[model samples]
Target chain A: MYKEPIFLQPKFQERIWGGKKLHTEFNYTIPNDQTGEAWVISAHPNGPSVIKNGPLAGKTLADAWNDHGELFNKSKDNHEEYPLLVKILDANDDLSVQVHPNDTYACEVEGVPYGKTECWYVLSAEPGAELVIGHHAKTKDELTAMVENQNWDTFLRRVKVTAGDFVYVPSGTIHAIGKGIVILETQQSSDITYRVYDYDRTDSVGNKRELHLDRAIEVTEVPHQDADKEQSVSTVHQLTVKKLVEEKYFTVYHWHLFGQASELKLNQDFLQLV
Target chain B: MIDGEATLTVDGKTFEVEKGSHFILPHGLSDYDLSGDAEFIVSHV
Candidate 1:
């Protein structure tokens, strides 16, 4: 049985809309100037974090979940890939407007265990930074017409945001993180995305990225449904515990402590970040 | 996180945690102690 906390080394990903804030702000040794994301506490096959402390040092987080199921209170026969992924995304440029399929669609069409239902906690945003959280289309045909007409200004719904703001993005919500904003995202351990818009931006190689309008439109909710989350705060041994969101996929908390907090326990699973 | 340092005690073992430090206190960890000063954002499923 492991008695010490498990530290992890993040795995970084390069992206077209990335920047160097992962290095500048978080002090991480990023791979390049376009270091877009840091998979901080992830076990997904795409970018699993490596353990950095105790007897499991140098093992991948996937290893811990696979080899030591008891560490997460899972049975030895449990074969589900670790279910949650935590990431820090630095959007130097706007991300592509995208949506994800639900779990049923993912299992039937994409043959995956889970779909993507993510939530973002804004870490920082420029003075005038904005985000695309929903769309203005009221029907499937209207949404398709807008996407086909290249009418982004009329089709997208924008919201201004700042540091410490939180947004819940369930599956099929058309969303994008605008430029000059950084966020911590928690979501189901899946990476299936369908892009609808990319601002007509070309990559360094002068090639345009693919747009999955057909799938995106097919999966998107006809009428955008805003996720209204109720938050509550309390004190646990002097630690201010703010329950951020409790949902079917993930439950998050923001904790603040100036002096000391004692006797924090966990019999399930946990991830901690600054 | 703010500028500060703290010692996290778990099962009689202590680990130093500061700004930008991330860790997980896996399942079966019943009790842990923290002292000094620091901030953390934790998640679970």
Candidate 2:
């Protein structure tokens, strides 16, 4: 029986808003100065994590899910590509205002298995750091008018963030991560993003990024609703555990171990990404 | 014990782990041994 924990090597992605924080903070050997995200525990085809130890060493997480289905306790009812992805994002600049489709919309329009409904655990933030959460649009017509007019200052809602703060972002929410912040993100496996605005920022080659205005309008919720989350704390073994959010996509928790704790590898019927 | 040390033994192979070290004990490994003290965080799906 496979009982050893699988440690995976992270895959990094370069972005226009990327920076060197991933290297300075996590001591990661980043690919470049524009490294924006580390796909820490992921099985997505774009950047699947490679197992670094044990019998699975050198194999991508996607490989294991496809070949050794038993490891994740894959059964008839759970046969949708890998279900989750974990990432650490370093936003040196603002990300483009974007939204994502849910499962039904994704499968019908994007031909993907899942949609993005992510939550962020703030790792660190500079003083007065903030992020774009919801929009100020009270109705679909208002949202459309604001986007058409490019009225960003009056349309976006920004929220201040600090270390240890948690934010749940469900699908169809128009959001973006502002500059000077690093976040640990957990979400559904799909990566179908529909960009609404890009701040007129051009790439190194001076080309503006594409905006999917039509799709964004179709998928985004008419009025934004913040996720209602009530965290609960508990002690398990010698670790302090805090439940972050339990939603349709996933249940996330933060564990702080103060001493040595022996944990048995039980058959959980599901894989964990840490 | 973020400031302490711990020795983790998996399948009879033991190693000393300290603060800021990140390691995984994969599934299917036998009951392992962890001695000493240390601090860490773990998350699972």
Candidate 3:
């Protein structure tokens, strides 16, 4: 009997290199505050209600999935459909050079059901903000040589990204969100980023995260390009799909909201918190 | 005896959904279909 829209909060992680950047979680009313932790949002394996509202008011998302699995018709092996993962990435420093695997590859190689294909809506970027996307090298050996030689400037396709730009990153596209950029990312519910190159940074324990050079090479796609397509769809309301970034798996619509009540028919059982 | 059901009438047409069974009445669906005594959950997307 709830009349208002339900909102979910994005759990934040305090990394060793993380700055004073706090993730602002909006539109979620989870019952258990403990579920939103530092690194990940815990979808209780035992099944309990984490959020307080929506069509699934009293039931946990897991319980709902268990009982109404027929609604989604998910396979026997896969459980997660659409997990809520949002990040307010404060790239205070450069992130590792990374690429993502597709669902099929992840399932076969990594034994995971889903792969990550994400979109970035640039909220703001400091002047001279740049992002490394795709490989300047055409072959895997060439990229390997560049990385070993530390020829980063030649190996990366650096773009001066600014606020209000929408970027869609397909799986296998080697990319990195550079320093001084903060973004709101929405993507398929998966967490399998293969870091090809890290700037030789170490964790608090002085242990560096292993670079999956061979795996990344296998997954990396050559010739990464930006989606420079304009938001051309005309609508009466200010709500328009300004930019659309699509990969083989999921499509992200960079929506431009300007105080308009938007109406949309549900395609899959989508969870939209605010 | 069958479990109690509710039939919802909208614009002269009716929709009968059982307590356990549900139907998605598509957006802009002018005509609806039903049997008189079925109960259901209704929502617009």
Q: For each candidate, what is the lDDT? A: 0.87, 0.79, 0.53
Q: Top DockQ: which candidate number?
A: 1
How far in Å is the alpha carbon of A73 misplaced in model 2? 0.8
lDDT of 1: 0.87
Q: Could you list the chain B TM-scores for each candidate?
A: 0.81, 0.76, 0.38
| lDDT, candidate 3, A157-223, per-residue tens | 8888888777777788888888777666656556788887788898768999888877887887765
Ranking according to TM-score, highest score first:
1, 2, 3
TM-score of chain A of each: 0.97, 0.96, 0.76
Docking quality of model 3: it rates as incorrect
- After superposing candidate 3, which stretches have Cα over 4 Å from the reference? A1-4, A23-49, A54-63, A68-80, A225-230, A246-248, A257-274, B1-45
lDDT at A99, model 1: 95
> Compared with the true structure, what per-residue lDDT tens digits does model 1 show for residues A1-274?
7788888899999999999999888889999999999998888989999999878899999999999887888877779899888888999999999999999999999999999999998988999999999899999999999999989999999999999899999999999999999998989999999999998899989999999988999999978988989999998776788889999988887877766787876745655554
Q: Score the docking of each candidate (DockQ).
A: 0.68, 0.34, 0.03
Per-residue lDDT tens digits for candidate 2, residues A158-241, read 999998888999999999998999988889998899999999999989999999998998888878888879989987566566
Give the higher-lDDT candidate: 1 or 2.
1
Listing every candidate in turn, what is its Cα RMSD in Å to the true structure after a full C-alpha superposition? 1.5, 3.0, 10.9
Better of 1 and 3 by DockQ: 1
> Which candidate achieves the best TM-score against the true structure?
1
TM-score of each candidate structure, all chains considered together: 0.96, 0.89, 0.68
